[model samples]
Target: MLLICHAAYARDTSSDSILAGGTLKPTDAFDMGAGHVDPLRALDPGLVYDMGARDYVVFLCSLGYTQAQIKSMLLPSPGVDTSCGGDESDLDLNYPAITVSDLSGSTTIRRTLRNVGRIKNAVYFASVRSPQGVHAVVWPRLLLFSRRKERITYYVTMIPLKRSQGRYDFGEVVWCDGHHRVRTPLIVHVNTTMDGGSSSGSLGGLQVA
Candidate 1:
């Protein structure tokens, strides 16, 4: 049985007659759960984002972990390089979420997705539900997969649209292949007073599809 470990990969495979509370953390959860989980949908999430044990090491290095500290954590693991020589940024981690705590200007984040559907030849197009005070766009929105587990990388460019200070806003980047709509939340915490450079022009007319 195929399993998806991340909640960001969860899809809503329910009909209109059924009420399905999704996996997104809600603002008001006093009467509801944090999120809902569908076992059937988890089994067949059309696209998935994955992270390996070694990738965490790179993430640690990006977070300013020292060489000794990183090596200490990876002890007894054979054939692993302990060098913090990678130029990979923390924002470039292969996680399915896009979050920017402070937007001082236009920022572009890259995400890679693997098509894990039963249908080998699947073409997915992207669409954006941009956040209230932010503009998000994905480049090369069309993803084509000819084989299972085929990886495709896309870039998301986000800029401040309203820049409401300390506002927590939510949006979604959705990919659909007619059968499944794979979506990821675009969370942004706006800091308007931080001299965010070039908050102008929608960062090149944000468009994904």
Candidate 2:
């Protein structure tokens, strides 16, 4: 069997230099290079969130884009009109990271993970470290992967407890299975407006092999 590897680029903070104020700051773009262990560890990542071309179409649809606009963006565009019927909200996109640009009150997002580890019976447990003023809840706290590339779905709901302290709040959701840990960052942008507006966003990370 042929083995293909993908390298992960990590933010190399070691290249950061001390500023006049004695604060360390990154002075070069190359500072965000790959970490030593990122590639090796990424190869056998216990769980990975996978996405396809159609999945991206659904995501664009969730962004409230017109069918014409979407078609224009598609290469060798389809001859027939495409619709985003039955598509979930943009927040529910199957991505490693969770982002809510216009959060108000409470909102729930869904994510799916695929087991890509060597072990067929690997199990994982979910944990969260919520940011200030935001509460996170993950349904079906435990996941069971009995076969390679098996998929599982879960939900994360962010509830705002108080007024916005700043423009953004950060958190993370992690899945652990004795050895491997799959973590995804959570970013929520507080919008006090009642209209519940939306923003354009993208997902970044590795895909399952």
RMSD of each: 5.3, 9.0
What is the model-wide C-alpha lDDT for candidate 1? 0.68
TM-score of each: 0.76, 0.70
Give the number of the best model, judged by lDDT: 1
Output the TM-score of candidate 2.
0.70
User: Stretches of candidate 2 above 4 Å error?
Assistant: 1-37, 76-81, 192-209
Tens-digit lDDT string for candidate 2 (15-90) = 5342322435532212321122476777676777777666777888888887778788888755544577865488
Give the per-residue lDDT digits (tens) of candidate 1, residues 1-209: 12233333322345222233474442321211212455677777888876666667778989999878988887587777666776867887777677787865677887788878798788999999888877777887899898653888888887776566666777778888998777777777777632333454332455322
Please give the CA lDDT of all the candidate structures: 0.68, 0.64
- On TM-score, the leading prediction is 1
- Quote the positional error of residue 125 for candidate 1 in Å: 0.6
Instruction: Count clashing residue pairs per candidate.
Output: 0, 0
Clashing pairs in 2: none
Worst 10 residues of 1 by lDDT: 26-35
